[model samples]
Target: MTVTTDIAQRQERRERLVLDHFADETRQDFDAVLATFAHPRYELIPGGEVLDGRDPVHAYYLQTRRAFPDQRHEIIKLRHTEDAVIVEFWLLGTHRGPLNGLPPTGNAFRCRMIALFIFEGETLVCERVYFDSLTMIRQLLAGVSPEALPQVLSGLLEKVPAQTPAVA
Candidate 1:
């Protein structure tokens, strides 16, 4: 194949891998999701969570999905960089279980997220996510009124600086 054709084919394969990851996640097919990665890893930016290796990444998937069993992504835009695919997506899910020691309030949340599907050549190495933590937190917390949201967010933001959690 020509160099240009080879590059295009590589991009196609990379994009397919990412889309299959999304599909497996939406299906909650954890094992299938795990298969898509050459190096299983995730970084939840707002939550300061980093899970690397198959076991930890599996546990991280379990924990988060346990909290939001219906969690799924809607791809809004996807652009390829030299080493990563930048995805702007909507993450939607309902609070169906305890999250971070808080009981579920049955409320749902929809948040826009930007994530990098990082790769070493054609092999996916990481999925790093960025989003507003406070918005999701507020939706999960019962009795958080629209009027009270600012105060609620401010309180959480204040506490954020105190804890630097190390993810396995």
Candidate 2:
């Protein structure tokens, strides 16, 4: 096969791997989820804490699984380049466990997200993610504390630093 075809095939596999990780996370399949990442430096960008290694990634997944027991990601688009894949997606779920210290409200929520996956050969080395903060706040507020929505939204934005380091 030509180099171009090989690159395309690798890109497609990388994209599928990313989607599988999200799906496994949503399903509470922690082991399956953790296999997709590279060791010692598997990084998730755009707000979620950076995990240094496989163990940390596993720990983070445990926490998230506890928080979002019913979460599921729906992919809207997948675009590939030679070294990266861009994914546009939406997450839908019910808040049934603790999330960022917020108590569960059992409220259903939806949020849109976009992520760029950087691949090193067939493995994903990093993921840079973007999502709508406003939508997330709205969903988290559903049936709980509408009056405090403004404050919650403000806090969310404040947590995002003014300057985010670029993903390599």
Best by lDDT: 1
Provide the lDDT at 152 for model 1.
47
Q: What 10-residue stretch in candidate 2 is worst by lDDT?
A: 40-49
How do the predictions measure up, each by TM-score? 0.83, 0.78
lDDT of each: 0.83, 0.71
Candidate 2 matches the true fold with a TM-score of 0.78
Cα displacement (angstroms), candidate 2, residue 33, comes to 1.8
User: Model 1 lDDT vs. the true structure?
Assistant: 0.83
Clashing pairs in 2: none
Q: What tens digits encode model 2's per-residue C-alpha lDDT throughout 1-168?
A: 999898777876787898787777777887887677665344444454466667877777677667677778888999988778888988787877866556666778888888777778887777667777668756777766668666655654565544545443
lDDT measured at residue 119 in model 1 versus the true structure, 0 to 100: 92
lDDT of 1 at 17: 92
